[model samples]
Target: MSDGWEDSADAWVASQGEEGDFGRRWVMDAPMLERVRRRPYVRALDVGCGEGRFCRMLAGEGIAAVGIDPTVALIDHARRLDPGGDYRVEAAEAIGFDGGAFDLVISYLSLIDIPDVATAIREMTRVLAPGGTLLIANLAGYNSAADAHGLGWVTLADGRRVHAMDDYLEERTAWIEWRGIRIRNWHRPLGAYMTPLLEQGLTLTHFAEPPAHGGDPARQALYNRAPWFLLMEWQKPRAGSSSGPTGRA
Candidate 1:
């Protein structure tokens, strides 16, 4: 059980050529950059950073950023792409860094790939400096739940398209295959993602379910009916504070 990513690393990197996949280009990257640019941070870490794209983006913005991933091939590719970047072979469950080392930590679409979600979340929180932020972009619970059971949108007799969802409460691993790539992704309920941060005393600062990209109308229409991704911003409380306010977008 190698998570199926070691073999797919080349295809994955190629699929995200130059910019990124469609979702990353239209939905994830811009919003993520906007959020990170709004504040100043000395150091940033990208946990489970596939190919180190986001880390490179941060470095281009003058932020000292490092990327870590468990997959050797992907880490090697990242290092080759940005020779000066600090990319390491590390796992999300036990990041090799001191506590309070990073003012910003990002897990962009990596949580789904991590099997030990709780431990990974705790480790991410541990490395974050007090008052720091943790930004995560992941497959939404709805999409995961639906895909787990092999359910997708189906047309009704009355010309309505609806997606059927099932087993959302069950936490398990599911296989996804597409265009010469295969990977195992964990499907956990929404609470499975939020509760760990809450338990660690992190505050939910922002949440977004952005609409699909504009250029492809048909694809946009399908996504408008059901969001494919979820973005969340959680912040560690400042010294002497128990919690912070939550924001939604």
Candidate 2:
């Protein structure tokens, strides 16, 4: 499973030979980076920072950013894109940064493939500076991926076919594919997603359910009908303050 992804990461960078700026500038990375412009964070960590798109964006914004990804190819490509900030090939779960090192820690659409996601979240919390924000965007809710794939169906216990969102959530599985690489994207209720953060000594400040992009205005109009992805903002309370969770949005 991991081998295909390791190769896919390299192939992805190779395929982006040019027009890489198109994605880093206009697509996913740019939009999210723009969203955090008003944040007062000075230092940030972009975990699983594949290709360092977000890392470069942060560096451009004057934030001292460090990008870490397990794929060497991605890091190499990132270095070529922007050598200003630090870039390292590392695991999302075993980050070596000292505790309370960054004012912000972000993972853009990278949590789905992480096997021990809870452990990864804990690592992120460990590195987060006091009163820092940890932003995460990932596939959310059951049937979200099926909707993205333009499919609608459910599998009963007896292997019967049913076609409905509710039925699917109750029985079927949903997966996500990025740049032709299919991976298991575990979907959970909004509370289930927030539960781990609470356990990691973080509090959810805000949540977003954005519209999908496909070009069809009518289809896009209905995209927000069901949230396929969630942007969760969590904060770490100040050190020596209180072990209890408390933070302003």
- Cα lDDT of candidate 1 equals 0.88
Which candidate tops lDDT?
Answer: 1
**Candidate 2, 202: how far from true, in Å?**
1.2
Mind giving the per-residue lDDT tens digits that candidate 1 earns over 56-115? 999988899999999999999999999999999999998999999999999999999998
By TM-score, the best candidate is 1
lDDT of 2 by residue, 1-249 (tens): 453455566656655554343323223443466457758779999998877766766776888899998877778878987866699988888999999899999988777656677788889999998889998877665444355454345568999754445433342334545665554544445555566788876867767655554445654544445554567788887766654544321
lDDT of 2 at 2: 51
Model 2 clash pairs are: none
After superposition, candidate 1 runs with Cα above 4 Å error: 148-151, 157-159, 244-249
Which pairs clash in the backbone of model 1? none
TM-score for all predictions?
0.93, 0.75
Clashes of each: 0, 0
The lDDT values for all models are 0.88, 0.68
